[model samples]
Target: MKKLLQTIILLFFFSLTSTVSFAQGYKIIGKAIGFADSTKLYLADVTDGSFKPIDSTYIVAGDFRFEGKLKHKVVQTYIHTKNFADRVSLWLENTTVHFSAEKGKFKQALIEGSQTQNLWTELNKAIKSSKDEKEQYVQFIKKNPDSIISAYLLSLFSTSWGNKTIRDLYGNLTPENKTTSYGKNIETYLALSKDIQIGGSFVDISQPDTSGIIRKLSDLKGKVILLDFWGSWCGPCREANPKLVTIYNEFKSKGFEIFGVGAETSKKQWVTALKKDGLQWVNVSDMKGDKNEAALMYNVGQYPTNFLIDKDGVIIARDISIENLRTKLKDML
Candidate 1:
């Protein structure tokens, strides 16, 4: 009996020491099971846009331990096992969580104790609602604008049809809670939204296209430029491209030019579409989807969006239809 008691004491001391040493940044202690092969453990520090190696152990015994300091305040924990699948877990400060992964994908939480659970619960409820997407979304924001869940949802739908609706919902928020973290995040997001109002025109700070090299947008100061936003997948844009082609051909000698901003996710698609569509104009894009950074800056919610900038690089019209665009071009040229 005395020997058994001594062994238990020793085991307790060892476990205590291990916990203290590994609990610095974030610690993931769990077992991974592989159906077809052995499982592997990986400890990555979610910083530098890459994961940093810390400690790794095999799951042959169905046990693993990972420990490391996160360079950033927020970091993600990933478990990549061979032939089994991959699992991802998120850890934040001042929280304790216990969960398991199923098929290396969805997390099955059998136990958890954290403040973030509230945010999760709220998001789950918001997503479960069966009302119309737009109206349900508007109602969610109206009720929980002061909660992180609402803030995140609002940010997600800000640039969609929810853009205007979400804005109006926030306006109805109580003034007291408007300065909360959720409120401020929404405010900052809305403030950064692109302004499409006429006058105080937008200038092209980018370099010009002369010398077959880098050029600034300011170089085309005296020429009226038709800034066309288009994509290869857009049938409307394709139909509009010919009209633009006609306009460019007619006005090229009259101090008018065409510049295209493509909204294509794939580089190959953008290039192929450009060639196939016979677009002989200067084009640029970040190669992101409709929610691209540039598109967000320009407040473009729909495709075939554009800005008719005067020679001085001032926005004269936005979302100008083909007929209106033709009339605007005639007046500008």
Candidate 2:
């Protein structure tokens, strides 16, 4: 009887350990109502605007499941099916979640489970009804500082808000949240943003132009520079180019120069637009489109973003109107 009791105790402890280990990761159970048999389902991990497939499974009787651990406790993940044609994006946490969808309609899937998911649902609903979505995000962070979802939302708004506003919001986050992946991203973003803020010294950028010649922002330091971030495909940028051409002609001899940075993916399109618009300026681009190195460095959230830099290389104004640019140039010249 003594030996049997010892054996039972050991088994009980082993079972408890197994259960705890399984609970440490995420468990996602999914059901697709009209999915075909042997269909492939892929789980993709998203980071820094890129998606990578991490796991895959085949559907059996319209049911599928994924079980794995995440490096970060909370992360953005996507589920793709139908040969990667259909996709559903969701936030994953260390908890079991249930997802359901219909054939060829994965994006409209229903997701359930986890407190963070519930909060995300509520936040989306609020965003749909609120006129000021940024304020709603701020309010949500204020209410749930410990939530990783709040950290993600904060990161999204980092480019729009001022340094002090972002820093204050970061301060409101819990100590644990401050160490999460998105939390660290926010910290890094704020650090970079401080350098490019209005009144701060301009950050230098170097990229190959259409002629394959390297152009550096510092090369035009002796002149008052209009660092224009624009693209051929951007309607507003195209519309504003003619006015900029006029401004450039007027100011070219007054120690003022326009350094146009095209946020274009296609080099052919960029060159064509430049010729068509009759823009005679120092235009340069790395040709990575919106992900252009200069655009990212400047934190340009919109096209036609212009930074008026003084001859001394200090940023004097940002996104100024055509009239404002003219007035400022007249006053300075």
Candidate 3:
């Protein structure tokens, strides 16, 4: 189930390429070559490490069209065919754009009409031709300090680039650029990451459980704990629940406990998953979705992140698998 709903909003707009046409938000007139008729073309958002299709169309006589208005002025999307072939990442704006590319060479396709797309094209070209990709990225940021693209690029690789380098690059961006959504998230992540790490005592997390009673992580002191950061929408988290149940049943009687913190967007879905998965352990959420307080306190960037705490509340393991948790529990208890 995708988070975004598909709504055909018919508004008024003037198209220079066509006569008597109507579109309010965004319009992408695409000409796809080397694809058979009825091939599906999808515009998907993979920002949160999940594949969600916002709009899609079928190839009719080598032509395809996708029209939708983004809530924001600028957003990122991946245009692809069936099985994600000919995938091309493009930054879209609320403007008309044309995409003309061959079957597998979508990356080299001619995309115009949006200034953000133009910048993306230039940046991609430079990155592809450079010997050291990181250096090229750094140079790009330095050159375009005021560009929103720079901030987004920095945030995109914040995890892989490490905190120091990301901070240095971010320091070079202008105040206006730093105020973008991506830049603000990076700032928040960096600040929160400092408070949580291995060998450090676990931070206290408070959220309402299924019964609407608030529970605190500090209350689980003196017991071996696994602080799991997960969501009901995450596939891997659901699949790992059964194994986690087995692990819990084994060592639960030996002062072992699992503190499940859900980074959920909806309370109904969270409660449903808890019941369906038979999660007997204490599960809690603030129901703030990506803005979840517990998730941000732990600086969780992806789903299914966990930390194993010792009896003294010191973080002993950063992300231990269920099997490893069992093994460690057997040795400890």
Could you say which candidate leads in lDDT?
Answer: 2
Stretches of candidate 2 off by over 4 Å are: 1-15, 18-24, 33-39, 58-61, 81-85, 103-107, 195-216, 230-299, 310-317, 320-333
Models sorted by TM-score, best on top: 3, 2, 1
The 0-to-1 C-alpha lDDT of every candidate, in the order given, reads: 0.61, 0.85, 0.83
RMSD of each: 9.0, 5.3, 10.0
TM-score, one value per model: 0.51, 0.69, 0.74
Q: Give the alpha carbon lDDT tens digit for every residue of 96-178 in model 3.
A: 99999999898878899888889878878888888898898888899999877888887777655667787888999998778
Residue 157's C-alpha lDDT in candidate 3? Answer: 72
Most TM-score-accurate candidate: 3
Candidate 1 lDDT over residue span 226-297, tens digit each:
667777878999888877777778778888877776776667787787777777778766655554455566
Clashing residue pairs in candidate 3 are none
lDDT of 2 by residue, 290-331 (tens): 656676568776788999999889999999999999999998
Off by over 4 Å in 1: 1-135, 142-152, 160-192, 205-216
TM-score of 3: 0.74
